[model samples]
Target: MVNWFWKRKRPLTRTLRVRSRGDYGDVRRVDFAELAPEIDTYLGQAAYLQLGFFETLSDLIAPTPELSQKESLSLAAGAALLKHRALVDVIRERGDDPLDVMLPFREPLDTFRRATHGARPLETMLSVQITAGMLDDFYLALSASYGATGKQVAEILQADDDRDALVSILKDAIDSDPEWSSLLALWGRRLVGDTLLIARAALGSQALDEEEEARVDPVFTDLLGAHSRRMAQLGLDA
Candidate 1:
């Protein structure tokens, strides 16, 4: 991932408006400097992240006892897989091997997945909902920097994730046990820092100067706003 943020300070005026599409209604206009990873890096990370989401959701299916819940999770998993394939196709169109592009990110992202995983199934489900939602919004914002490829990536991400079913399942769990409300809320809060780190890392920088922070803040602010709504919808306080 090449650093797109030049160290020199400059007054930031660039803005990217992420239009609401499909079930991606929460994405909004955000102002940020022109910052993005290299196209291969962007496509690789985005592609693998979707694959991770699919794997996490699919893993949950076998342990899930309810047939309806299994089917719902399956749908969401399938959506993630479809997005992954779409992204990989884009990589191929660019003449890059998907595996090579994605390889460099595998370990760090896998570590991230393990860190976000929960001891219980419901908690893990919330992890997926909150984390995936935040990262998707982040990618949508970053997609604007890549021109035609960005548009293609944005379209793939905007497709209905079918995660609403997971939300319903979570709501049912909370309704049955009020305790879930607090537990999941706590887990959701814990996810923010880690997810934000991943978002920042995607910018290919480990640290940002004050000017850089100012430029990047609005994008993160929008991400958090959308994140809070997602938590609230699931009856969890973020």
Candidate 2:
């Protein structure tokens, strides 16, 4: 009888893995009727939709106090969402990591520039990307070295200063002593971050501009002509 019971019986198990903490799939489902500010629900749901998973960076590593935690999480979540959206859009277009698409096409573009000798459209694209790269670098340097305070970085970028003078200052400081290496590294990182910020800001400005249609309305017909002329001059095809 013991053998029969043991053979017939089976162990029972029950468990559920909850992947999300929120009730809404998107913005509209949130209940805004409560008297309290709904920023948590609003931001949290946006974060989940963008990331597919959510965790506070602080809590993931350390014991953060309750008072400032949510705000800090929301700030990171906002930046992450922007990154995710940009990456997804680029990946959809190129079937590769967004970095491959978004990075300034310097070497290839420079080669084409040298071969073609200052052709108009190629030059325009090169100029834009160069400016974008500079902005990205600036932001990166300031962020990593100076605590990532957006306002302070913005003030630095917005300051009216000569680029040549800044470069000279940086180079002199670097050559002055070995101790300056850390400062130089920080400066280099800020320049990279600034370049990224430039590209994204330009992307946003163009996205919002009413004049966008004036260029895109023709469906990039002239772009093909510019591209073919430039590529042919460089002896590149396909």
Candidate 3:
């Protein structure tokens, strides 16, 4: 069942507004040591989510006989696995147990998956694009606030192959059936709504400070802008 919240048609900026100030937060510098634990936890959840996405993709592609399509799917899944391993390695290097760090997130992530489970291939792809893109944007914000280590992990997490592949598939699908464009645009909106809701619930649990809260609107704006660009790239309404 789709959540009622996913049906909301509010603009992203309005939905994600942290406060009425509309002022961007100054990028406060943070050392790796200061944010290490939080970063580790965030990366662990990200790694787990990526692996889950691959598993979902793998299942979807399993019965397909097209070699080229299979190859692309495999490559995307392989990239996700590589990202997972990199995140785990970083967590271990930080002297933290990766499993322990990710444990708290399992429930929320699982809930998100269940809530946003797509009924169609295009819907699934849009969900993947929105979820992965939002995570990347969040990491980018962290990288800017934190130092070199955060930057390194953000860079490592930055892989557009899967998104690019999905976009191609979406474009082909929509082009073949022009009527699909409208449906997909709606699906994309639902995906974005659900994703942001899940993100807010997860991050809200982390108890962000005043400055961190102040950063929310700007990061959300960046994310929404990226989503718009992606939708435009695929010839879908943002």
Tens digits of per-residue lDDT, candidate 2, 77-112, equal: 344445446434434443544443333332322332
lDDT of 2 at 30: 14
What digit string (tens of lDDT, one per residue) describes model 1 on residues 1-238?
2122222223233345565544434556555554556777788899999999999999999999999999999999999999999999999999999999898888878888988999999989999998899889888887887789899999999888999998999999999999988988998999998898888877755677787787777778777878878887887788
Off by over 4 Å in 3: 1-37, 63-65, 202-214
With candidate 3 superimposed using the best TM-score fit, by how many Å does residue 177's alpha carbon deviate from the native? Answer: 1.0
Better of 2 and 3 by lDDT: 3
lDDT score for candidate 2 against the true structure: 0.29
Locate the minimum summed-lDDT window of 10 residues in model 3. 6-15
Q: Summing lDDT over every window of 10 consecutive residues in candidate 1, give the lowest-scoring window.
A: 1-10
On TM-score, the stronger of 1 and 3 is 1
Better of 1 and 2 by lDDT: 1
How far in Å is the alpha carbon of 107 misplaced in model 1? 0.3
| Number of backbone-clashing residue pairs for each candidate, in the order shown | 0, 23, 0
